[model samples]
Target chain A: MKLLYFAWVRERVGHPEEEATPPAGVETVADLVDWLRARGPEYAYAFAPGAAIRAAVDKRHAKPEASIAGAREVAFFPPMTGG
Target chain B: MAVRLQREPFDAGAEAARLTQGREEVGAVVTFTGLCRRGADSGAPLTALTLECYPEMAEQELARIEAEARARWPLADALVIHRHGRIRPGEPIVFVATLSAHRAAAFEAAQFLMDYLKTSAPFWKQEETEEGTSWVAAKAVDDDAARRWDEG
Candidate 1:
């Protein structure tokens, strides 16, 4: 799957997008966030617990528990500030 | 209905005119423009604002919001245009225009579109000041505003 970061999350993660394969047990958005957090200090900082992060799976807004099975893209970002 | 995401600035007046050009039956036209301001969070002068978005997702999300507004209101036409990239203070960042047969529907639908766009759209804004730059944090008030639409 392709993982995307935006706003400060992208700045912390140091990149906008990347390809990654999660472990078999990583089934939901929260699990994937945990997995990314373990990749490095930057990823950890970006996905740190209590961070105001939001997610979208396949271009749709999703909650932490939303399933990501067979998804092509997942995006993580701060709560949107658009108007 | 039209939703456009662009990097260039948009003319709000032209957009509003296009929406109501030949539509005599439209009694109300509500147009809203959101602009970048000169002040930062720290009371410093903000030089510019950098706006970014997931291109495909932003377009899809805006379309979804526009569709919802149409579903809830009897709209004759609706147009949404949002700009991304570096914008100077006093420059327009977004424009929304809604036309209907009555003032109530046009006014409410335009507000609904803006409220949802504030919270759900896939755009992020970063403010640049003399000291440094920082991402603008999302406000709880915006979430509350969006949520109010769900209740009776």
Candidate 2:
């Protein structure tokens, strides 16, 4: 699966997008966040607040409880401030 | 529904003109322009506002919003133009134009689009202030504005 990061999340993660496959139990967005936070310091910082980070699955807004099963792409970022 | 995410500044007059020119069915056209502003938190002097977007996602989200507006109202047409990258104060940042057979539909649709874009769009803004750059904070009022559309 491909994952994307934006804004400060992108800056902290040190890249915009990447491909990764989580372990067997990492099935939900919340689980994914916890797993990614354990990957390294940068990932840890990016997902620090964990729940504060917003996410989109397959280009649609998704809650943290949403399943990532069979998903191709997921994007994470802070709440939008666009007008 | 025409949605564009570009770094180039768009001519509002031309865009508004193009959207309603030959469409006689469009009795009203409402346009809203968002401009970069100087200073933000702590009163630091802002030199520019840098906007960032997730290309595919931003486009998809915007298209979905446009589709919703069209479905809920009798829209003749609609256009959304949002700019990304560095934008100085006084420069236009975004433009939304909605056309419908009557003024009420156009007006409401435009406002709805703006409210959704403010809270749900995948765009981030950083203010390049004299003290340095910082991301703009989201406002609760924007969420409340979008929530208004959910009621009867």
Candidate 3:
């Protein structure tokens, strides 16, 4: 699957997009986030200690509980307020 | 329909004229202009807004949003103009216009385009404030707005 980052998340992750294969047990979106946070310092910094992160699955905004089984792309970013 | 991703501020009247040209089925026009804000929720003094995007991805995503709007409404024309680079307060940030056979389609199409853009577009904005420059975060309200569209 392709992972896209935006805003500070992209800055922390150090790239705009990358193709990746999630590890075992990373079934849901929340689980995948936990796995991503454990990847490295960049992932940890991007996820941060306690910041509100928003996500989208294939360009559609996704909730934390949303599934990731069929998702070909996933995006993580901070909350946006642009009109 | 024209979807433009540009760095220069757009002229609304000119853009509207461009979209309406050679089209006779368009009976109603709805337009929305988004401008840069001077402050965030904390009321910090803001100087400018710097927008960034993934060049290839931004264009593809915007095209998807416009296509979805057209599928959902009977629009004769749709125009989405988004400006990148640094913009000061009161400067235009984005413009969305929908031309349809009736007011209802135009109105709904405009709203739908804006909602989808808020959630799906890859544009990122950083606010240069007196306190310090900060990257803007996606709001829960925007997620809620986009979610509602799925239910319809």
Candidate 4:
């Protein structure tokens, strides 16, 4: 799946976008987040200790508990405050 | 309604005129242009700000937001333009204009667009500071502002 970062999310994650194939257990957005958190210090820092990061599946806003079974893309970023 | 995402700052005056063009009933025109501030908090000297957004996603989300605004108000027209890439302090970052027959509708729709844009748009700001580069997070105040719409 294609993963994207925005704003500070890219800064924290150290890249603007990337493609990833998650492990079998990563069936949900939460699960994918957990997997990403375990990747390294930067991923951990990007997710932070317990930040309320938001996710979007297929360009529509989604919650962390949302399923990612057939998702082609999942983007994670902090809440937006732009107008 | 028109939704535009550009790297060049927009001319709000020209945009407003264009939106209201050929509309005699549009007695009210309400607009909001978000400018690059020093910083949201302590007024830290803002050297530069960079905005990044997904081109396709941003356009789709913006169209959805504009549709919602029109559904909720009797608007004559609406226009939203946001600038991305590197920006300097005091430069315009966004422009939202609503035209309506009455002041109340124009005002409400304009505010609604701004509120939803803040939470719904994909644009993100990176602030370059003396300490270092910092990613600006979603502000609690912005959420509060959006929440106020639910009260009615």
Candidate 5:
């Protein structure tokens, strides 16, 4: 799956997008975030539990409990402030 | 229904004219244009605001919201145009217009579009200030504004 980051999350993660294959047990967005957090310092910082993160699965806004089974794209960012 | 996401600046007058042109049945046209401001809340000099979005998702979300506006109201047509990339202070950020047979519908639909777009759209904004650049946090007030429509 392709993971995209935006705004400060992108700055912290150090990349706009990347392809990653999470371990088989990771079936939901929250689990994926936990896995990503363990990968590196930047990922840890960006996906920290306390961080005000919002996500989209395949371009649609998603909650942490949302499944990622058939998703090809997952994006993470801060809450939108656009008008 | 028209939803356009582009990097080029648009003329609000021209866009509204295009949407309302040749529509004799339309009695009211309500238009709202959002502009980038020079300062955020810090009172520091501002230079620009960088807008980022999930390309395809942004258009889809805007269209979905516009469709909802059309469904809830008796609108002749609805239009949404949003600009991405770096925008300077005073540059137009977005434009929304609704055409309807009554002023109430036009006004309500336009406000509805703005309120929903402010919260649900997949776009992020970062303000560039003299002190330094910072991402503008989403306001709870915007979510509350959108929630009002849900109550009905």
Candidate 6:
């Protein structure tokens, strides 16, 4: 799977995108976030609990419970501020 | 309908004109432009605003918003253009134009598109000041504004 970060999430994670493979039990966006958080302090900071992070699965807005099964891309970012 | 995500600036007048040109059937046209401002929350002078977007996802999300407006309103046409990259204060950042046969539909649809865009679009803004740069936090007011459309 390809993971993307944006805004401050990207800054904290130190990169915009990356490729990673989650274990079989990582089935939802929340689980993936938890998996990434364990990778390093940076990921932990970016996906810290209570952070206002939003996620997308394959470019569509996704809830935390949204399944990531067979997904190719997932993006995480702060809430959008566009107008 | 048109959704353009560009790095270059856009002219609101030209965009509005393009939507209404030669269309006598269009009785109402509403155009809105959002601009970068010189003030920051900390009372620091803002130098510029950097807008970042997920290239492919931004386009798809914008098209989805435009399509929703079209489905909900009796719109003749709608155009949305949002700019990404560093924008100086006083520069236009986004433009939305909607056309319809009646004033109510045109006005409401344009507002609907903007409200949704503010909260749902895949774009983030960072403000630069002498102190430093920081991401603009999403406001609860914006979420409330978007949520209003869901109620009667």
True contacts kept of each: 0.88, 0.86, 0.36, 0.74, 0.84, 0.90
Pairs of residues at least 3 apart in sequence or in different chains that clash in candidate 4: none
Sequence-dependent TM-score of model 2: 0.96
lDDT of predicted model 5: 0.93
Residue by residue across A1-83, what tens digits does model 6's lDDT show? 99999999999999989999999999999999999999999999998899999999999999999999999999999999987
Q: Between which residue pairs do clashes occur in model 1?
A: none
lDDT of 4 at A73: 82
Question: What fraction of native interface contacts does model 4 preserve?
Answer: 0.74
- TM-score on B-chain, cand. 4: 0.94
TM-score of chain B of 3: 0.94
lDDT of each: 0.94, 0.90, 0.83, 0.86, 0.93, 0.94
Give lDDT: candidate 4, residue B59.
90
Candidate 5 lDDT over residue span A1-83, tens digit each? 99999989999999999999998999999999999999999999999879999999999999999999989999999988877
> What's the lDDT for residue A46 in model 6?
91
Candidate 4 per-residue lDDT, tens place, B1-152, comes to 89998999888888887888889988999999989887644467878988878777889899999999999999989999988999988999999999888999999999988998898888888888777667777788888887888788
Chain B only, TM-score of each candidate = 0.98, 0.97, 0.94, 0.94, 0.97, 0.98
User: How well does candidate 5 score on lDDT at residue B4?
Assistant: 92
> What DockQ do you compute for every candidate structure?
0.92, 0.87, 0.36, 0.74, 0.86, 0.92
Assign candidate 3 its CAPRI class: acceptable
Summarize candidate 5's per-residue lDDT along B9-35 as a digit string, tens digits: 999999888888899999999999999
Each candidate's iRMS in angstroms? 0.5, 0.7, 2.6, 1.2, 0.8, 0.6
For candidate 4, what is the interface RMSD?
1.2
> Per-residue error at B56 for model 1, in Å?
0.5
Write down the worst ten-residue block by lDDT for model 5 chain A: A74-83
